[model samples]
Target chain A: AQRVTQPEKLLSVFKGAPVELKCNYSYSGSPELFWYVQYSRQRLQLLLRHISRESIKGFTADLNKGETSFHLKKPFAQEEDSAMYYCALRFMEYGNKLVFGAGTILRVKS
Target chain B: DAMVIQNPRYQVTQFGKPVTLSCSQTLNHNVMYWYQQKSSQAPKLLFHYYDKDFNNEADTPDNFQSRRPNTSFCFLDIRSPGLGDAAMYLCATSRAGKTYEQYFGPGTRLTVT
Candidate 1:
């Protein structure tokens, strides 16, 4: 079965420190990956997609096909960056349904 | 702004009672989806509507049902609310294509007693 895994349930980093949220997936075919973020009391929003290859809010993710990973990274963590991040895979076979990982809670402490 | 909207930001219901959560989108997307997100967990796909065609997840409980009256509106009906059903219900919309980037609404948090 195709599955997306976010190994870190919670990650804490001091402000100005580099941050990385690890995401891995198991799929037989080409995978379309995305990173979604949800801040406190805010609706979930798309942070970035692998196809877009664009950096948003100082966050970037690179898809490593050989490793089957798409890890989200930021050069310097901001206090406001504290949020829940989810890694999702688009399952093309099932009307392009999004299968999401367990998500990582990133806490950037000041 | 073109956005997805879910009504009743918070809902409380008694056990075995039926409740309906509504969603509307101004984006006019071709697809709408409902997700159940429990605390400290990832959002789970409950069902979706491609235009007017409904698709339910294989593992979705029979107690959950959905309706899309038109392009801009969708509803999630829980037949009998249970304590385990307490969670945040999210509504999202996307255009039909290979590049399916979904836009989500501010979810409705459901509480069952």
Candidate 2:
């Protein structure tokens, strides 16, 4: 079974602080991992993908196959960065279906 | 700009009544998907259309049906919505490939009364 787990329901941080949202997956096959963010009154959009190996809005995530984890990290948090973040995974052999984590709400306070 | 569009940002329907949610895309992507997201829960895939090929999830209920009339338009029909069916239905589109990313719409918040 393909599953994603985001244990924290909320992660509050002060502006300029480093932030990290944890994500773990249960899959034996090669998987494509993604991080999606939804801002207030905005649509859900892609923030980052493991395949691209690039940072977006100063956030980056690295896939660790040994741990089966793809954790999202940022050097410094901003007020505009406060949003709901979801970690998703796609099974390579499963017709390209996406499986999402429960999500983590990042509240960046000044 | 080319993007995915979902009509009726908010909807209110009586229990056991039928409701339909519409999605259209200007990106001309080859794949369209329908997802149901409950409050505080991750979005769950219900069904998707790869061009004209319809694919349904194994756990999807028979009451939930989808139709793709053309390349740009797709519809999700709930034959008899229940109270538990109230959720935000998300529409997304992607090109047929392993790397192409999916673009999501603003989503429709369905309220079952």
Candidate 3:
């Protein structure tokens, strides 16, 4: 079974500071990685997927196959960026059954 | 707007009682999923409906069952709720067959006492 690991349970940063949320996965086959976010009092939503290679809300993650990592990154964090983030891995063959990591709560303070 | 919806955002049920959580979608998606999430824990996949077929995870307790009468509707039934069943249940939908980006509902909070 594929599994995702999010090393940090909580990450705190000041506004305008750079932030990185680390994620690693254990899967032998080609994996499709995604970042999902849940804001306070909001439903969980897709942030970005590695397949698209497009950044959303100034956040981007690069898939490092050798390292088995896909870390969410932003050059400068904003207060609005505070939320819970989850890393997920979708199997190439499985029908949309996602293996999610324990989420990391990102806190951006002024 | 096409979206996933879960009703009764909050539910409270007595221990060993039966409770049902409803989910419906306007997207007509063929895949619907039920996930259980505890505070500070990852959302665990319990089961999903692929078209008219139902698939349950191996570790999922027998207490939990799901019914999808049609493409637009699905229900998660807990036969006998326990204190440990208290958690947020999330419903998600996706297109048929592959790992498509899934859309999630606001989630239903189930509290067992």
Best by lDDT: 2
* TM-score of each prediction: 0.95, 0.97, 0.95
User: What is the per-residue lDDT of model 3 for residues A1-110, given as tens digits with 9 covering 90 to 100?
Assistant: 67899999999999999999999999988999999999998878889999899989999999999999999999999999999999999886665689899999999999
Q: Give lDDT tens digits, candidate 2, residues B75-105.
A: 9999999999999999999888743377999
Better of 1 and 2 by lDDT: 2
The ten-residue window of minimal lDDT in model 2 chain A covers A91-100
Off by over 4 Å in 2: B98-100
Model-by-model DockQ, in order: 0.70, 0.68, 0.75
**Model 3, chain A: how large is the TM-score?**
0.97
Fnat for each model: 0.67, 0.64, 0.78
* Residue lDDT tens for model 2, A1-110: 78999999999999999999999999998888999999998888889899899999999999999999999999999999999999999886776888889899999999
Query: Using lDDT as the measure, what is the rank order of every candidate, best first?
Result: 2, 3, 1
TM-score of chain A of 1: 0.97
The local lDDT score (0 to 100) that residue A9 gets in candidate 2 is 99
